[model samples]
Target: MGWIYLILAGCFEVVGVTGMNKVIKNKNVQAYMILFTGFIFSFGFLSLAMRTLPLGLSYAVWTGIGTVGGTIVGMLYYGDSKDWRRILFIAMIVIAVMGLKLTSS
Candidate 1:
């Protein structure tokens, strides 16, 4: 279940990133709640994942997921750049995350 927790942590990290974007655009209690709650859950799950996963492997995968997730969120909801180069880099990150998962025991 360590992998599950790690994936959840990564997802929550994206939620936190979204909250950050919201807070930047509009400061309010709801946004603040989302921001703090997302990070709290993210860190909690990450710690749980560390119990079974190697530190380096876990951190790399977590950040990879977050980076990909956040970038996609930006592209989808925030109207960030959708250039081919940006998509190519996102795909690379996904491939790297998959490779790490495959290599890990």
Candidate 2:
């Protein structure tokens, strides 16, 4: 349950970041609203997940998910650089996040 909440938090983090990008590019009020809501829900879920997960482990995973998800979002939707090196690094982050999850008790 805690892990579920953490995963949801990470997803919301991606939403917030993507919203930020949209707001910056187009100055859309709806994008700003999404950014605000996403952050609020992200933090709220993260706090709930902390009830069972270790602080360090939970934080690392949450940020890892956000980093990877945001990078993909940028590439797919925002036309970010799609260099091989960037993709490789994103893959590395995914591996590390999985490793952390597998090792956690």
Candidate 3:
């Protein structure tokens, strides 16, 4: 349950990131709503996740998910570079995240 909430928090973090970009580009009421709503839910779920997950482990995983998810979203929707090197680094982050999860109890 904690892990699940953590994952959800990470997912919302991506939404927040997206909203940030939208706000920067457009700066409308809808953009503000997305940004605030996304971050609010993200923090809410993160706090819920902390009930069972260790602080360090949960934080690392949450940020990892956000990093990876945000990068993918940028590449797919926002025209970020899809360079091989960038992808390789992203893959490395994924591997390190997996390693952390494996090490955690």
Clashing pairs in 2: none
* Cα lDDT over the full model 3: 0.94
In order of appearance, the predictions have TM-scores of 0.98, 0.95, 0.96
Candidate 1 or 3, higher TM-score? Answer: 1
Residue 96 CA displacement from its true place in model 3, Å: 1.2
Instruction: Report lDDT (CA) for all predictions.
Output: 0.95, 0.94, 0.94
**Model 2 per-residue lDDT tens digits across residues 43-96:** 999999999999998999999999999999989987899999999999999999
Instruction: List residue ranges in candidate 3 displaced over 4 A.
Output: none
What does candidate 1 score on TM? 0.98
Error of 1 at 93 (Å): 0.4
Score candidate 2 by TM-score against the native.
0.95
Worst 10 residues of 1 by lDDT: 32-41
lDDT of 1 by residue, 1-105 (tens): 999999999999999989998899889999988999888999999999999999999999989989999999999999999999999999999999999999999
Q: Which sequence of candidate numbers ranks them by TM-score, best first?
A: 1, 3, 2
